[model samples]
Target chain A: MTDLYESQRAMRAMRRAAIQRGVVAILDVGTSKVACLILRFDGTEHVLAGDGIGAMAGQTKFRVIGAATTRSRGVELGESCAIQETERAIRTAVQAAQKMANVRVDHVIACLSGGQPRSYGLAGTVLVDGDVVREHDVARALASCEVPDIGPGREVLHAQPVNFALDHRSGLIDPRGQIGQRLACDMHMLTADTAVLENLIYCLKRCDLELAGLASSAYVSGMSALVEDEQELGAACIDMGGGTTGLSIFIKKHMIYADAVRLGGDHVTQDISKGLQVSMSVAERIKTFHGGVVATGMDDRDLIEVGGETGDWEHDRRTVSRAELIGIMRPRVEEILEEVRARLDAAGFEYLPSQQIVLTGGASQIPGLDGLAPKILGQGVRIGRPLRVQGLPQATTGAAFASAVGLCLFAAHPQDEWWDFEMPIDHGAARSFKRAVRWFRDNW
Target chain B: MRPMKDPAPSRMAYRMNRLMLTPRFRLFLRYGLPVLLIVAGVSIWASDEARRDALAERVAELRRQVEERPEFMVRMMVVETGSPEIEAEVRDILPVDFPVSSFDLELDTLREAVEEIDAVASASVQIRGGGVLAVTVVERVPVAVWRRATGLVLVDAEGHRVQPLDARADRLDLPLILGAGAGAEVAEALEIIEAAAPVTERFRALRRMGERRWDVLLDRDQIIMLPEDDAVTAMKRVMALDHAQDLLARDIVAIDFRNPRRPVLRLSDAAMQENLTTRTRVYEAVVE
Candidate 1:
């Protein structure tokens, strides 16, 4: 546990040094596309470390100087399946972006969508040793939370404090300098498969780039897609990508739940290819240009030519009605939405103050999805695009680039994590367990 | 009948347990509070002027502590390639105190200051071992002495003023130039003086005429008018003629070489009257 804390602190220090040097790269390794964006920090102001609550603090400090994307290979379901192919693809994207920006970057902050994330909420309280609450008391309260056995192959990605309480008063954002007998804390922890993380680190090492930071794509996408009010209240951002559908729940401007379904837009494309007997590339083209979820009577008359390149004349050309194309796409999209709804239900998302569900990503571009989403995923459903960032090219300002833009925001103003604090280490193991139990008792 | 009691507390306990197990609540306290505290602290620090000033002062104090370490102290400064007077002038111009921290010294600014001195042509400053701030300067050498109305000023090859001389004999090795714009034409004058080395003992001064051409003055009230375009070659031709014909010893007042194709000589008044008498006597003899 201390090893993890130490490494996290070291990584934060490295990130600060990189930012001070005035350039950092943001890499988004997704299922369908791998994108690299080089950001140049003008170094006008020193970004205060550990300041996580302010959203617009570092907004104008950085600008995208270079952006490049290439078709992802050897990656399936948002995880790298072939090391060498993914390395080659990453090199191509990074080199192209560096050439465009005319700057070489050695530090990178990467985001990924796989690893089967699990969310856990833990609470703890500590009796105030002083008349007024202080930072150490808050740290003690956080440390008193019960550490669950997240299993051997999993690692914690994000552990953030979402709520606080002082004595009888609950939902206190900050209890410091306030008179309270006991201080309580509610923390949210997200863990992912360790193997996936190790693979990513190894790949970065092979590419000769330092891994300064890492974030869950689902969490960052919610950060970019959801409005400020939506995040403050409660909302869920479902990012429909090529091979994975990432889901993240945000409340009080913090991600409380994150999960990914192994099915995404590529499944729909495969359905089209099998249904119309067309090549995968041609199916993708048809899906992007003519696909829709909700069909109308007018769609029946619209015919799309499904061309083939086989030597046979009969197989070279074929035609399908737009309605039939919709028929092939609607079911798969519905399945993805259903899976997302199930995951949200499991997370008890409906109990939150707001239930706004935002659908964003490449697959969310299907026509009529906004009309059909609420029917399957319940009310208050909307299609979302990534928030606009300064200096982003016209091609990258779309729903598909949510994670990339969010990564930029995350890199500029990262939320404080567990390792950022100085944990108390004087207590013996047995006494610490007892203190944990007692703190839990007082909070309950 | 006993099972009809409200299960509200139990239900609340179950909900609390489930909430505690979720990722959101755990992350909120663990990561979010520090962020909030830091933001609050930073905003407070930034907004409060007095506190910000105090923080800046503390940072500056810490930086000074590091900079004033023994290894970084400049114990002495050494000046190279200058006379004692020039070295003293350089030291006065440089803005550094002895035993000062090297980081506090701006080397480029110091170099510029040293170059601003009248005698310094170029200066280079570097920090060498043994706590030495070594400054190497190349001082300009005076090539000619210009006799201006105010005083005699020493001028370098590029016609830059080096210093003022109390007397012309103080720098007898340098050639003397006269007139208002003579300092700007020092290079050409020096070249002409070198070409007239044979007659240099008889040469007195070279004056700039109308800021275009030169009038070479000799010891015996004789003047050589030189053309502007090929003044060096013309001076060389005059020197060759003087060497062959002892032109300075002849009864001539001026040698005009403004037009290289036509060289003219103006004889003295006595010499001209003697020539007229001799010509009249020859005409009378021819008539008889």
Candidate 2:
């Protein structure tokens, strides 16, 4: 736990220094594609004083100078399966973006879609020392939270204070200068597989780049894909990518739960390939151009030729109806959605004040996803696109680029986390005892 | 929800919460900005046009403050190697205001201005210690007095006019040159005058005739026409003959040394009559 806290602190300091130097790169290492974006900061202090009052305060002035996306290689189920091939893919994407931006970047903040992220809601309370509650008291309250062991092979990714209460006054975002005797904090900590993170760090080191910051793609996808009100009230972002479907739940502008399903669009593609007896590349092309989960009566009349390069002309000229293609695609998408629904149910998302569900990512572009998502994932489901940013190319501003664009925003203005504060060093033993008690209170 | 003692307090809290939640308030906080900023920007841009002018003046004032430090100020100007009169004229032509910053003064331009004066041969300007502006001038010295049709002008060895002389006796120590192109030929004329220094009192002036050659005018209206190529040598020889045999003291009116091999001397009337009597007696003796 100390090692994890120390590394998080070191990364936060590095990120701050990088931001001060004016330019940083955001790389989204996803299952199907690798995207890189170069963001240039103007070093304006407007963000420091505004705090959480406005979302645009910190995001008003950054520009994307370069962006590049390439087909991911040697990555299976959103994790690197082959080191050399993944390194080459990363180098190609980063070099192309550097060429476009005309700058050599050393610091990069990366996001990954794998790693099996798990979110925990930990609550802590502390006694205010003086008549007024100060920043250190809030830090003490956050430090008092009992961080679960989360097993041996996982590390904490994000530990952010989601809500605060001072004495009888609840729903206080910042209780500083308030007259309170007891301060309480509700923190949301997300942890991921440790080996997956270590693999990414090793890959970045091999490429001669420094990892200044890291975030789970599910958390960032909800940040960019959901609207402000959806995030502020309650919502969930389901990012269906090539090999993984990421789920993130947000309430009061904080992500409280994140999970991923291994089944995704690639499963549907494989199903089509096997069912139609076509090559993988042709299946991908047909899926992109003609595949859909929802079919109409007219789809039966439409025919798509599945081309093959065999010497037999008749065998190469096989045709399939659009209905048959939909038939192959719908079940897999339904299965992925069912898995997502199970995760949402397990997270107690139905009890939230607003159960809005936003569906986004490359695979969410199926013709009738908006119509089918609500029926399967409950009501208030909408297809979410990434928010429009300055200088974004028209082609790159789609559901597919949500994680990359969100990574840019996250690089610019990261939410303050528990590790950002200074904790008292003398009360380690007492703090541990209190943390154990709270752990029991939270679990049993 | 806790109940408020009065509706006013609860209503105030509700209004504050509602205001904080409004998108307009968020925009106002993010970019629409503090009212002070808008007021400052609009007031600066929309007020009297003199605001911009005042801003420029303020910038210039700040630059002046930085540039006018004690080390950069030129407190005194010292002129070296110039006569009192030339130094005064140098001061007049130099474009510098005393006690001004040296950065404001262009030393190259000052040097050029000082050299433009007729008496200044060359000049250099530099900044010395103790806030001093040192100007060194090499004044042109008068070597000959040119007698022009208008007046007498003192000219240097290079035939550049140094100053205007009031009278011929004002600079009697300098040699006198006469004619249209005498100023340009002052060097050769001075050479001839030096060669004829033995008859310094009898030498009146060197005249440049037809823009070439020299005619030496002596005290008794005797004109010695020297050839152009070896005029200096001819003058030397004439001076030598006059010194050895008192050839110039005799009753000769003119000597034509244009053809050096055949020198001709034109005699006075009395000497011509004596020469006729002597030639008749010599002729009778030769015939007998």
Candidate 3:
């Protein structure tokens, strides 16, 4: 745990250094594709002191200079399975982006969509050290939280203080400088499998990129796809990626719970391949062109050629109705949505004030998923796309790039984490030395 | 089925592409490498002393070819002088062969050399049309003739010697000045001669007395010694005395106006003797 903490701190410092360099690359190592977006910080000169922290947030300060996406290889469910192959894929995407941006980026902020993310809610309380609660008290309160046993091979990805309470008044955003007997903080800590993170790190290292920060793709997708009102009034974002369906719950602009089901668009493609007796690539094409849920009579009449290269004449000229393609794609998508619904129900997402569910990612582009999602995942289910960022190419402004775009925003202004605050014990020796001096002075 | 090739780059290719994209390396490849190559090539070619010397010799030969072109060649010299003697003197002093390149001519130094001639006051040298080296000289006008103990020489008003004279009578139109250092004050001598114009008929020459004052010698052996300060004014005073009193016509052989307040005149021998005899006769008659 301490090792991971130190590594996380190192990563945080690296992120600061990368931002100082004014150029950082956003790498989304998804299951189906690896997308690299090079962002150049244009400076915060136009961000008026307090104005930009509102609706626009920090997204105005950076512009996407280059973007490239390549078909992922040797990665399963967002975990790097084959080291060299994944490195090659990352190199291809990064090289293309570097070519486009005409700059060499040394630091990269990457997102992972798999690794079995688990969220833990922890509440810690500490007595106020002085008459008024100070920043150190908030740090002490956060540090006092009981770390749950996240298992032997999992590491904390994010530990954010979601709420602060001063004495009896709960729901305080910041408890510092408030007169209170006790300061309490509710922190949301997300931990993921350590092996998955190590694999991703190794791949990035092979590509000559420094891991400045690593985030769960589900959290970042929520940051990008969920509207401000939805995030503030409570909502759930389901990122139906190629290899995993990730869901994150947000309330008061803070992600309180995040989980991913190891099932996504790739599974649907697999299902189509199996049901229609076509190649995986061809099935993917058919799915993208004609795949949908909640099929109508018109889909039954429309036919798609699911051809093959086999020498057999009938096999080469095989065709399937659009309704048949939908019949093959809908069940898998429904199973992924049902799994996401189960994860949200277990997370108590229904208790939030708003039950807005936003579905995004490459898989969410299925034609009739929006019409079919509310039935399984409950009401307020809308297909969501990533927010428009400056200098983004027209071709990349689709639902598939939600996490990639969110990584850009996350790189700009990351939410405060537990490690951002200095540990109170860091100043222990100095404080003791001063105490010794004060004791001598009082006696003399 | 022919297997589909992997779209991913090989590790070597990827590393090479990244190395090429490094901004510093790219800039070096684009600009620094070419400059370095050219410099290295030239240095290697020039490393031998013989090669360096050959290159220098070739450059000099090229320069010589350009300089010796017909357009820049000066075929002959033209001296514009007031007299043929002066022109011949100038041509003899400058001993340059004909058909020399103008680039080989130092015009400023040649002009200085030409102006050093006694008869030449100022000169300018230039290469003009038809490949002619044109030397234009302004000849000094000899204002007076000065007779030195060594010889007679024509001197200008500013007292610069122009040429030698064979005899005093050879330039009678010019007033003759004599004595050491008289050439330096020819201007003052000319002014005094102008003041004594009324007695010009008797004026023989003006001699510098003590190299400070002037002594005017007239043809009848009359001599006027003038004061050093305002010698021209004293000459003018003597002229005024001659106009009013016919002073030059008298038997006075020398008039001393060195002290202008007191004029002293020395008469000739017969005039003095007749004056003494006349005085004696008048005394004897008075006794009877």
Candidate 4:
């Protein structure tokens, strides 16, 4: 048991440093495309030792050695519609990224956009041996946290003890060996369906990369795009992608909550394709060129020619007003934003600082998106771009790739994971555990 | 009718008496033979080869475990740093003096054999690394320097022997335990000592005496003895009290607050010796 715990601890620590060693790949399965990037970090000293304190300044950084994007195949919306189709797409991206980077990455950190995730806060306490609470005592207290019954067929994705205190004193970061009768800890845990997680892991195994770690797309996107101040002061990053819009909240430089809405840019594209009697490709072109929610005075004369393949030239082309285009796009955009607004409210956005909301994603690049955001998402809105990372190509930095880019940042600096904190092999429910230990000494 | 014979009865009468005298004897005669035969048959079958093999496997596993090393994994890390070479000041301790497979013993008994070595924290000769024997030594992470009347000695909080002070305080943040024989709790005492590392720049020494108590000597002439049952707990309470109220800044000689709930203060000898003062009780907890 102790050996298992240590190995788990080592695996968690290896993730960030391993990615920077110039051998990391990302697997993103979305409805529109199966995107993959093999980031080969190139620099002097790939791993930073002792609290990222290198005075070399900007001399060290990662460069995108390879990249690939394949059309969404065998995937319905964000989740897998069929396993074999998804695997094929992943293989294409992996091969492309590998061919470009000139290396084979055998480890991948995958990100998922859709899952029913709920946030729960738990606190646990353990009595110190005598009155001096040591580091082991605090760890024992955290292990005492009752892993919630997140329902069957679901596995815990993240279990992190964020805060700790000894006795009456709080905010003791590493209370390993201080004396106190009571040591307390606050922990956060995230769970996802075992089937969903297993499917992703299975797909990656086929790609020949070990599943190193997993993160929610919304969570990584929030980390990559939100600035230090935005993260510290509190802000919401809503990533409007091809198949889904990911939402996350950041505070204290950590992503506290993450969620997603199934509706995305594809839905709007479909509305236009069906409304304009055009193919998805043509609808996308028109949406990119003149898609707007709020039609102004200049939009009325927008004479767009509709063409057909038939030989009758007069019947083949018809003049369409810009207002009609706006009419077709506005409702779908509103529906997506409304779904996101509900998720924000559910996440308790009112409690966070600044509460500044930033919208980014493939659809977020639409012309009238900035105007449409405030009406549904409230005030303090802006378009966000991922910043402070190296080795990213300009083609990959768009709002649509927020999750993939944010994944690079996550790969660079992961937060304190579950294995970092020391816990006894058989950490149990605190109250009964204390009672049982004390009882055994007395009875046996 | 058999009693009519008085002193003794005939064999036929005796047999009849045995059957009638005890309720259990009659009951056994009715049910015992079948049960005894069944038990004897089952016992005969149970001591068979299949059962014997299972027991043999269990015994073998237990014996294997008994021979396994009891030391921590770090001690067996292949001695990655040091090298074996012949220099002018020469040492052949690696292959000859302690031949490749010469020593085979655990660390508990060997600690005392090398206690006099100033540079050695603790060492053990072990038979490992593929038939090659090597000395396993744990260097002390020094926390403080302790001075005594007889001599200057280097000791860990647990009372294990260590190297003398090197004046490199910036490199190591450890607390010193003075007096003597603190080795038992020294391993655990390091935890308390390290907790004060961030707060206290350098601890003077933690002195042990009376075989039951402790005193942490900080800067100047201050001495602090810990509680008996939970010394680490008492030290933490003291640290907390000191951090919150600055208890250490005040001029003091000895503190006898072994009881965390009841703190007793003793004035420092510097002023007491000069003015010829007596002991005084300052803060006392009222018993319920």
Candidate 5:
């Protein structure tokens, strides 16, 4: 296990990088804000070693030096929708943090909220011509997934042969040299739309930064939000952001599924805007200041001044009871939870051993969200904060910036890079964008 | 006085010089000279002993170093001899405590232990601490046995010796080639259940004659006769054939490709299986 931790590719240079100056950076791109953290990775060598992360604890030795956040431009939900705006936001946050650290980086790994993502479970079998089942047999079984022909312009993001079964036997790890007549494999394949990734790459390129990596926001959020036990037992992280709500499921310490919904906190603000006949700015302010699901007994007499700039003096200072604010926010939060629940149920969540639900991201901090969440999501529900990284500042360590902080962790300690599919030929020969066209196609 | 001193010695000077030659002066030289010599001698002896001890310790240290130096060097040598380019590759994965693959080859200690298993031509073992080991091989005179696609196995004399190396092409001495399941009977071989051993300085290969008789091929490409019925006659026939035929004289092609009776001999491919008449064929036919 200790050896595996060092050899895992994501922490590639982390241990070595930790030895010198102990500095690393994390950048989180969201619809509402772009945040960057410059961590001074110190006191981590021994601490990381204590965690049994030997050898490469060499890389986790910096302290949290500085952090910066800027209002997001054209990024909606998670995916970069507009180049100039997203680039500007990324540059602003990065420059601010770099100025604080007085250092610059040439590479950055950006994460987006959504893409036309799909998951497929595939199984394969090999007739063991030789008496011993070996590494070659495993390779052959994984290779037998067929091209999948996800079409041109799209690429396979992750392909893992998650399970193996020897002849007549099932669920084996490493059948090598075992006298098996046949070998079988089960794989999980994740693919995303090519254009969505291209836009992210382009935005980073505009900042003159190489796209070192790209992650699904939901996956990283799940990594930060889910505890060890919950991750092992099975849990879902529903990251509620301004533009979209990201959902991810973890089992056996690996993310088995990830997805996003376009409906998020912005929708709630819009709902409040239309219902109260107020502008978006007023609606957001009210949502943050007066929002609550469970009204206390004293809330009946509480009054909030609803202001308008119209000429009528009475209309300018209209008063509304605090109960009315709860009435507006409760249904929207419930709707998001309901949609998440439906998605989880469809994914066979009941089969999982643990059904713990964690709500994170900026929108999850809505008061009384935890009390209302369990009723809609399931038995276990909780608000989650990003595990405070070694060198993170107090300002960046909030539940609202969980996605961004988690993004920092993602950049700091990415899980193993996947198969790195060196495809023989481009799947692009097939019809590109046809499947997802119905999504943006109907809207456009 | 600007003048030189007188050459004559005074009486007073002579008297003082005599006092110096008295017993006290004589005794001082005797004791001090001898004592100094003894002390110097002992000091030299002690230094020599310390140097000798230091030298012995160095030799022991060298011996230990010699023992350790070979483990890694030998392992790397095996990898290099097997694959010329493997030196770089082996070094890259250095300090590996385990062999990359263990089963295909193991140092053949137990298998080579049997006295009758002379078929093992040569063997060597190189172990890298990473558990990556290289076992180098040179197979023995496989008289005959089965060869398969999976790997070649060897069979030795006594008609019973069974080993996978018998079929290895590199061990050209083995001629009794058969496929899988064909070598079952030979696996039951005894050292001499078949016959008294031939005096075999020039013996090269042996073939199973129809699984019933045996043929021996000599180094000079001569085939010697062996009888199926009597072990003694086969021996006598083989010895006589060596003497009478002047077997080593001609560059013989085959003693006989077949029809071993009378052991009809041939010199060329054109003469293959020629001169084919003899009483109840004695048995063995071996060609180099």
Candidate 6:
């Protein structure tokens, strides 16, 4: 835990240095595409209240100066499988973005969508040290939370204190300067496979970039896709990416639970390729152009040309009906949503006041998804695009770039995590020092 | 469907691209490099002594071509003055050749040289339009002719020497002040001459005595010695006395008013003998 704290703190310091330089690159190493956005932080100013413009969740502080995307080569399920190939893809995206922005960015904030992220809810309480609760009491209460055994080869990615309760009053976002006998906080910690993280860091290193920060794509996409009210009430953002469908549960504007399912749009593409006996690229084109979840009578009449260059005249000309294509994709997408529903059920998402589910990412663009999603994942499901940002190109303002856009917002204003707080002096090395002092007092 | 080939830049190309994107390096490539190349090329070309000398020679030749244009050439000289002799003297002293470029002329030094002439009070030298060098001179008017031991020289009222005179008859209208250092007191001598207007027919010259006082030399060997401090007043008193008593016609060879309180006269030799005989007869008459 201390080691995680030190490294996360170091990353925070690196992020500070990057923001001081005013330019940072946002790299979303998704399975479908490795997207890079060069963000130039121009500092923040308060907007006038009654002018129909709000704070915009701190997104106004930075502008997306350069954006580029390349076909993901060696990344599978958001983890780099082949180091050199992943480095080449990253180099391609970063070089393109740098050329567009005309600046060299050394610091990068990246997100991963794989690694089987697990969420843990931790609660701890401490007595107020003074008449009014101070920041020190909050840090003490946060430190008093017992760390759960996250198993070997798993690293803590984010540990945010979601809620604070002062005495009888619960759901207090900030407990400082409040009269309370006991200060309690519920913290949400998400951890992922350490090996996957190492691979991502190694790839970024190979591309000559310093890893300033790392975030889960599920949490980031939730930040970008879900509206303020959905986040404030309760919502689950299901990012239907290529190799994985990442889902994160947000309540009171905080991600309380996050999980990823391995079966995704790529599986559907593979299914189409197998069902129609076509190439993977052809299936991908067929999926993007004519893919649907609900098969109507018109869809049955629609036929998509899946051309091939096998040099055999009969083999080259093959066509599949849109109903058949929908037939191939619906099962996979249903399976993914069912898996997300199961995860959300296990997370007790239905118990929340508003159980809104937002489906986003590259695969979520399948037509008739909204009509098909509520059957498996329950009602209140909607297809969501990322929030519009300043200077973003029209081509990139899609569901697929949600994580990339969220990374921009993240770089502008990062939420405080457990590592962002000062560790209570009574823990770790400070305890040993206190022990030594006690021993000296006894001897004297 | 297009081929699924992954395209990426080579490592060296990527590094080079990033290097080119660096702000400092880009600025250097955009501005500094071109300026540096130009300066280096110029310096390298100028490194050879012969080439540098050729360049300098070219510049000098261009300047000479511009200077020697017909419009810039001073073809002749003109002197604006009241006296022709002074103009000739100015032309002689300057000694400038015609059809020379005005650029080659130093007008200020020429003006200083012209002002060095004795009769020229002030001078200005300029090259006028139509290829002419005009020299304007202000000539001094001689107020007195000083009879120095060397010769008589025309001197201005301020006692500045104008020029040498061959003889006194050359400027008879000007008064003569004769003696050592008399040129310096020409103004005072002229004042004394003005005061002795009543004895103008007898006035021959005003001679400086002992370099401090003046002696008015009249015709018929008569002289009036005037005091130094107010010699003009002494001359005026003498003029008044001569007007009332016809003092200049008396048989007195010299009158001394150097003391100013007493007027002393020295009689001529025959006049003294006649004065003694007259005095003896008057004494004999008085005794009988």
Between prediction 1 and prediction 4, which has the larger TM-score? 1
Best by lDDT: 6
Q: Write the per-residue lDDT of candidate 6 for residues A226-295, one digit (tens) a residue.
A: 9999999999999999999999999999999999999788899999999988889888988898888899
Deviation from truth (RMSD, Å), model 4:
41.7
Per-residue C-alpha lDDT of model 2 across residues A112-147, encoded as one tens digit per residue: 888888889999999986689877788789988987
TM-score, B chain alone, candidates in order: 0.83, 0.75, 0.87, 0.43, 0.30, 0.84
What are the TM-scores, per candidate, against the unseen true structure? 0.58, 0.59, 0.82, 0.54, 0.51, 0.83
RMSD to the hidden true structure, all candidates: 30.3, 26.2, 4.9, 41.7, 37.2, 5.3
lDDT of 3 by residue, A41-152 (tens): 8666655444311312233488899999999988999898998888988999999998899888999999999899999999999988767988788888988999999989
Cα lDDT tens digits, model 5, B80-167, are 2333233343334334433223333334542243222333344455565654455444443446645555666655544344455532
- Model 3 alpha-carbon miss at residue A158, Å: 2.4
Query: How much DockQ does model 4 earn?
Result: 0.00
Candidate 6 residue spans exceeding 4 A from truth: A1-24, A40-44, A47-65, A98-107, A124-155, A177-182, A205-212, A274-277, A290-307, A310-331, A418-444, B1-6, B16-27, B178-181, B202-288
Q: What is the TM-score of chain B in candidate 2?
A: 0.75
DockQ of each: 0.01, 0.01, 0.58, 0.00, 0.00, 0.61
- lDDT of every model, 2 decimals: 0.86, 0.85, 0.89, 0.68, 0.63, 0.90
- Candidate 1 lDDT over residue span B17-73, tens digit each: 435534567789799988999999889779989988999999999999999999999
What are the clash counts of all predictions, listed in order?
Answer: 27, 0, 1, 26, 41, 0
User: Model 2 — TM-score against the truth?
Assistant: 0.59
lDDT of 5 by residue, A1-444 (tens): 123222333334432343343545567788788887776555543444433213344454345566888878787656678887777777777667766775555456566776656666777777764689755566667656554667776655555565668878875544667788878887776667778777877776766555545667778888888889988889999999888888888887767777677768888888888878888778888888987887887777889887876667887688778888888878888888888888888878778888888999889989888889988887788999888776577887777677666666665554533232222121345325644654576588
Cand. 5: chain B TM-score: 0.30
What candidate 2 gets wrong by more than 4 Å, as runs, is A43-45, A50-60, A310-312, A427-444, B1-288
Clashing pairs in 6: none
- The residue pairs found clashing in candidate 3 are B202-B219
